[model samples]
Target: MTIEHAVPADQAADLVRQLYRAFLARDPGDGEVAVHIANMQHDGAMAAVSDIIYSQEALSVRAHAEPARPSLPEGMLAISRADIAEVVAYALEAARHDAPSAYEVELRVDDVGRGTPLAVVLRDALQPPQLPQESVEDDASINRTIEIMYRMALGRMPGPADLENWRGAAGNGGRLSNVVFGIGESAEAKLIRGAFDVVPGIKVQLAFEIVLGRGAAAAEVDHFRRMVDKQGSDISPLVWQLFADEARRRLLPPQHANDPHLAYIFGSRGAVTLADWRTGKKAVAKTAIKHDVLGFESVVRLRPAEDCVVSILTSLYRGGAFIRSFLENMTSQTIFRTHCELIIIDANSPENERAVIEEFCRDFPNIVYKRMDARVGIYEAWNIAAEMAKGRYLTNANVDDIRRNDSFEIQAALLDTLDFVDVAYQDVLYCFEPRLPFEEIAKRDFRSDLPVVSRYNLMEFNSPHNAPMWRAALHRDVGPFNQSLQSAADFEFWLRCRAAGKIFYKVNEAHAAYFVNPDGMSTRPDTRGAVEAYAVSRELYRKIVSPMLVISDEEFLARVDEIDAAPLREGRRYDIVQSALLALGTRREGVVA
Candidate 1:
C-alpha cells in the first residue's frame, strides 16, 4: 500500500482561511482556523475542505452570496438563518437515529467547547419532548410564540392591542402552524409576495380589452386560465404571450381585408388612390372659408374687468347630449367664473343641436355664440373662434368631453404662478360612458418632467393637445391652426410654437375626462387624416425647423423619410412625426440664425 503525506499544519490553516473567504465572503476567526487545521490533519486535507464547504454556516452564506441555481420563482420568500439552522439540526438528528444508512454521519460541533457531539446534544435536548400530561397550557407563553412567529413570517411585530386580540383568539386551541398559515395567506402577505388579486380569467379579459380593443371569447379565457395554472399562478408571462399572439393576429392580411378604411389606407384592394385624395381635397378646398373671410363682426359681448381673461372655445357639431353635459360642467365653474368667458362657434349642426347651444347661451351670462354659414372642419372653426377671442389665454374644449368643475380655475392659477410659461396642461382620464358609472379606459398623466418642455422630446411625443390652456399671444405669433391639415393641425401648431421658443407647463392632476366615442371621426381609421398629418409635418420641417438647423435639405429629407418608413397604426400614424423635429433640434447648435 502507498502512503500519502499529510498537508503541513500552517499550510492547512491558510487553506481553511482561504476557503472561508472564498465561500462565506469572510475570513475565518482564529479559533475556527485552528479547529479546521486540526480537522485537516486528522481527516485529510481534501475531506476537511469539502466538509467546511458543505457545513451549515458555509452553505447558508454561499446560498445568499451567489444567485440561486434552480432559479427561484419571481416572488419567492427568502430563507432565513433560523430556517437553515433548523433544517441542518433536523437532518443531523435524522441521520444519527432514524436513517443512518441513507445519510452520511458527520460529527458537527454542538457547543463552543466542542466537547459534546451534535447527535448526543440533540438526544439530551429532546428526551422529554412530549405534551404535558397535566394539560397546563400558559396563555402568555402561547401569545409570545404567536408574536415571534408573526415577526419571523411577516417581518413585523403585531401592535399591543392587536396582539391582545390575537391572544384572545388563540385561546380556542389554535396551533403555531395555524397562526403561520393564516398570516401567510393574508391580503397583506399577498401584497408582500407581489401577487395580484386579479383572477386569471379577468386578466385574460382585460388583456384582450386593452391590447386587441375587444373582449375575449370563452374558449380564449379558458385557454389562458390553463396557462396561468401551468405557470404556477403567474399571469405576467401568459399576458405577454397573449400580446404576442394578438400582434400576430393584427399582422395578418385577412384581418384588414373586411375593413375598407384600413385596406384603402394600406393600398390593398379597394384602395383610395392618389387621384381620389386630390378630388376630395379639392372639393373641401372649394368651400374653404379663411379665418379673415368668415364675415363674423369682431364684437366683444361681455368683457370682464378681471386681470386674466380665459376664453373657453367650444365648436359644437351634431352631439346635442354631449354639448349639454359640456356646458353644464363649464357653467358650474366656481372660482374662476369671473375671469372666464365661453365662446361657442356652431359649425352648422342640425336644428336640435343648435337649439342646445342657443339655450346654453341664453342661460349663461358671458357666453358668445356664432353660427357659421357652411360646415368647415373643426380646425377652421377653432381658427374662426380664436380670431374673435378677447382673452389673454385661449383653450379649445371638445363638445363631447367632460371637464372638472375646478379645471379652468386650477389651470389659470398654475399659469399665473409660473413665469415664462406660454401654455399650461394637465393629466386627463378617458372613460367610455358619460355618467358617474363610466368605465375608465385609460388615464394619461403628462406630468413626468414639468416646466422644462424640450422641443426635441416634444418632437418624439406630442403633448396632450386638448389639455393645454395656451396664451392667446402664442396663437397670434405662430399663426392660426393650419387649415389644410385635418387631424394633425394641433400637432403642426405645437411644433410652430416650439420653434418660436415657447414653453409649456404641466399641472400634475387629472382635471379632465375625455369621452372615447367609438364612431367618432377622431377614433375611426381615416387615411386622409394620416396622410395630411404627414404632409403638415413635412411642411413644418421645411418652413420652421429647416431654417433653424444646420443640416442640408437632403439630410433633412432623408431623416423625414426614415420616420415615414416606420410602422404606422390607424390612430397612432403620427407617432414618429417627431423624429425630424428631434433631428433639427439636435443640430440647432450649428444653426445659421
Candidate 2:
C-alpha cells in the first residue's frame, strides 16, 4: 500500500510505536506490532495505524483518563464509540490525504487522545490553515513562512533543528506549499481527518472517488447533489440509487394503492391541526403498514389482511431517543404482524425523527406514520391518530414504554373472550429503568401496584395505567380524549366512560412496565402542574358523573376517610358510582388536593 511504502520500515515502525503509546497511553503487547505489520502488508499501513489509534483500548483509556473534562461539545454527535469508529474507518479507507510524519504524529497526541470530537479533528485535517504566500528566494522570508505553517499545522513553533532542515529545502527552490504540505499530510493530520463523520458533500465526493472512480464533474446530476444535502448523515438511500446495481426507479419499496386505513402516503409534505387531521386533511408525511417490507427475524408471524383487531396509536414528540426501543417492542408482539396496526403521529419534533421513522416504516408493514406540521399536545396527537385508526380496538402507545412480547396477545385475547368488557387494563410494573429490552425487563422483579379500576381507585389515582386496550367503539360513544387538560386528560376520559356505563376489566397480570424517569411529566420534582390538572379534571368529572350517582357529591366526599382505611384486596371490585367523585376539594383556579 502507498502508506506502507511512504516511509522506510524503520521510520514507520517508530511512528506506529509512538501512535500506540500516545493514543492508548501504554506500550504495545508482545507480538502486537508483528501482527499489525502483517495486517499492514495485507491491507495498508494506515489500516494498521487506525487499528491502534481508534481501538477499544484507546477509546476506553481516553474516556476514563479525562472524566473531569467538560461534556462533549454541543451540536456534535453523542460520543458513541461504535458510531465514531465506523465513521472514522470509512474516512480512513476512502480519504486520499498524504501520509503523516512521525514528529507530526507525536505532536497531535494530545488532541487525538482527548475528548475532542473526531469530526472537529477530521475537519481540521482536511482543511488545515493555509501557508502564508511569500517570495521564497531569500532565506529570511522562507524561514518566516515555514515557522508560521509549522505552528498552525502542528500547534507548535518549529524547533531550531527543524527550522534549519525546512530552510535547506526552501533554499533548494522548494515552494512554500510543498514545504508545508508535509506537515498538513503528516500522520497526525491524516488520523484526525480519518475520524470525521462524512458530511453530505463529502459523501458525494467519496461516492465519486470509490464508485465512479473519478472526481465528480460540475455538470453531474443536480438532483443527486440536492438529495445528499437534504439527507444529512444517512446517504444510503441516495447511494443505492446513484451507485448500486439496483434500478433507480425501484429504490423505494412499492406503497399500497388507496390504503383505506391511511390518510396520505404519496403526497407533498405539509402541516395539519388536530382538527384538520381528524377531517382527513393531507399529512406532512405518511406510509401504509401493508405495503412496506417485512422485518427480519421478527418473532411475529406475517398475517396479511385488510382488517386488524387492534390499532396502536403512538404520538411522538421529541421521542427520537426511544425510536429503536419503540420499534423493537411493538414488532415483538406475539400476534401476527397484520393482526394490529401501528399509527404514529409525529408532532413536528425538532429532532430529525422522520428519517428514522421513514426507514423503519419501510421494514415494518404495520407502521402507519403521519407527521404534523407543528407540535401538538400528546392527547391532541392521540386523537388525531385515533381518527385514522381502522381496528376494532384502540390503545395509546407511549414511545418510551416497554411491554412483554405477549402483552398484546394477552390483552387482545381478553377483549375477544369477554365481549362485555369495553376497556381492558392490566397491572403495570413501575420501575426506574424501563429502557431495557422487553425480554430483559420481563425477567425483572415486577411490583403489581395497579389494582382493578374501582370507581374509588380511579378517583384516588390513574388506575388504568397508560397501557390499557379499549374498544374503538368507546371513542364513538364517549368521544376522543379531552384536549383541554394535559396531565389528567386520560383520567378524565376514563371517568367519562364510567359515567357512560362502559365496563372496564382489569387483567391481573403485570406485563406492562411504566418507566418512572425523574424527568417524566408525572415524576418530576415539582408536581404542581399535575396537581392543578388533576383538580380541574376532578371538577369536570364531578359535573359529568355526579347526576348518575344516588348519593350527593358531599355525601360521597364524606366516605374518603372510610375508603382510605379499607383493606387492600387484589381482586376486589368497587363499582359504586359515588366512588367516582374525587374526595379532594376543587377550586375556581384548580386545587392541588
Candidate 3:
C-alpha cells in the first residue's frame, strides 16, 4: 500500500468546510455535526469528527481504500454524536494500520467533483479513551458543549433560542426565534439549560443584538422564562419582592397581554403523566397530540417537549378544613412560597368553597381563588387549573387530597433526578380516611412498593395517587381529565402515558399523605362511577397488564373470587383492629378460597 501524503491546505479546508456544510444542512436531531466540530482538536495535525467512529461496519462512509471510494451517505450528515464517535474511531484505526501510515486521501463527492480540492494530512494521532454518552447522562460540561454546537450550526451564539435573549421580545414572543430549536434527541436537556455556547465573539455580538433589539415586555420575559425554566428559579418571598420592586420601579417591561396561551390542558381518565418530568413537561398520549397550531379540548401546546410540564398552575384555589394543615405542611416542607397561586376548583360546596378560597388567597398574597360555574369533574378542574396555571407544573390538589410537607418540593426534586420518571408517588397511604394512626394503615395502601403495573393493573390497582405535581406540557401529549369517566380518568391517562413511556415511579419517601374523602368527586361515584371504573379498568387491564399480572382465566377468576369473598367494605375507614379483622374475616382460607 504505497501511500502518498498531501498538504493540509485548501483541500483540507474545503473538506472541513464541506463536512461542516453537509452537517449543518441535514442537521441531525442532536446537532451531531456541530458537536464533532467542537470536540475535534484544532491545533493538531489533523481534524476529525469527535466521536463519529466505533467500528468499521457502523461507519456510513468507509474510509478504508479497500472499500474503494465509498461515498459517505447523506444520512451520515444527520448522525448522532454518539454514533459519529464510533465512525471516527474506525477511521482512525484504518488510518493507523495502513502500510504507508500517511496517505493522500482524495475527496470524492457526488455533488462536488472529486479533485475539487479537498484533502488532508492523515495525522498519526492516538485516540483518547472514549466514554459512553448515556453513562455521563446530563453532565454539565458536555451539555454546555452541545449547546454551543447547536447554536453554531444555527449561526448564532447565546442563540436567540436562549430564553433570556427574548428579554424584551414582543409580537407573539419571538416565536420565530424560538422554534429554530429542533426536536433533536436530547431535546429535553437542551430546553432545560437554555444557555448556549456561541463562538465567544458571536455570543457577545448576539447579547448586544438582544439588548438593543426591540425590547420585550416585562411580563413577556417572565412568561417566556416561566415557559422553558431555562433561567432556573428561586421561589422565595424574595422572588415576589423582586416582582413588586420591579413593578414599582417601572423597570418591569410590558408583557404581551394578548397572547392567548394562558393554559395547557391534557385530559385523562386515570392519572397525570407529565406531573414529575425531569426536563420539560412529560408527554401524555391519547388525550393530547402534536398539532401545527394550538390544540382544542386541551390547553394550547407550548415547547411542550420541555417547557410546559404542568404542575401547580396557580396556588390560588386551596380550600376546605385542610387549608391550615395544608399551609402548615407546605411551610414545614419549605414549598409554600410567595409565587404560589392556590385556586379552589371544588364546586361541591359553593359557600365553603368560595369563602375558603377567598380567605386563603387574601391571607396569603401568593394564593388566589376561582371557580367553574358547573362542577367540572377532577380532570376538567385539572384542565382549568392547567389553563390557570402560572408556574412550571400544575399539581392536582383534590378537595380531599392531603399534602405532607415537601409534597411539591419533593416531587420537584425527584423529577429533576430521574428523566424517565414522569409521575411519582411517595410512600403514602390512601383511603377514605388518613386520620387513622399511621400504624393502622395497610401496607398495600401505603404503596410500600411503587410497582409499574402493566397498563391493566394501573387502571385497577392505582399506582400514581391522584395527588401529584405535573409538567404543563404533558397536556400536549396526554390531556386534561377525561370527563367521560366519573372515577378512572387519571388511570386512563396514566396508562396511556405509560404506553408511550415509563409509568409510576415510587419516591419511597413520604412527603405527603392522601386521605380519601367520601365527598371527593372521584369517590362520589354514581352508577356512572361504577360503569366507568369497570370499563376503564377493563381497558387498562387488557392493554397494560404485565406478565406478573397476567394469569389464566381460571387463576385470575379464582383470585377475583378471593377478593369478592373477602367482604371488603368498598368505602370505609378504621382505627380499630377488631373492625379490620371482622371486615376482612379470619385470616384463613375464607378470604382466599
Error of 1 at 499 (Å): 0.9
lDDT of 1 by residue, 1-593 (tens): 00112456665665565456544557779999888777755644434655675677766765465411121111111212221223233333322333221111112212312444323433333343356453444767766655655553455787888577666666676654465567656676667546444444555555555665544443344334433332223344445544655564556564342232221211112343334433443453223211221123522122335553788877777767677677777888754458888888888887567677678767766888888888878888889889888877889888777776667766666566565888887655544455421112122211122233565545444564555788898876889988776677887888788778888877656566655554455555443654555455444443332221222223434555654432321111134346545555656756755
Best by the lDDT measure = 2
How well is each residue in 33-110 modelled by candidate 3, as lDDT tens digits? 344344442321122532233223324333333322222322113322222222233344543543211111111121
**Candidate 3 global TM-score:** 0.36
Give all candidate RMSDs, comma-separated.
27.9, 26.1, 26.8
lDDT of each: 0.54, 0.57, 0.40
lDDT of 2: 0.57
Which window of 10 residues has the lowest lDDT sum in candidate 3?
99-108
Q: Could you tell me how far off, in angstroms, the CA of residue 208 lies in candidate 1 after the best superposition? A: 35
State the lDDT at 513 in candidate 1: 64
Error of 3 at 262 (Å): 41
Prediction 1 TM-score vs. true: 0.41
- Kindly report which residue pairs in candidate 1 clash with one another: 459-578
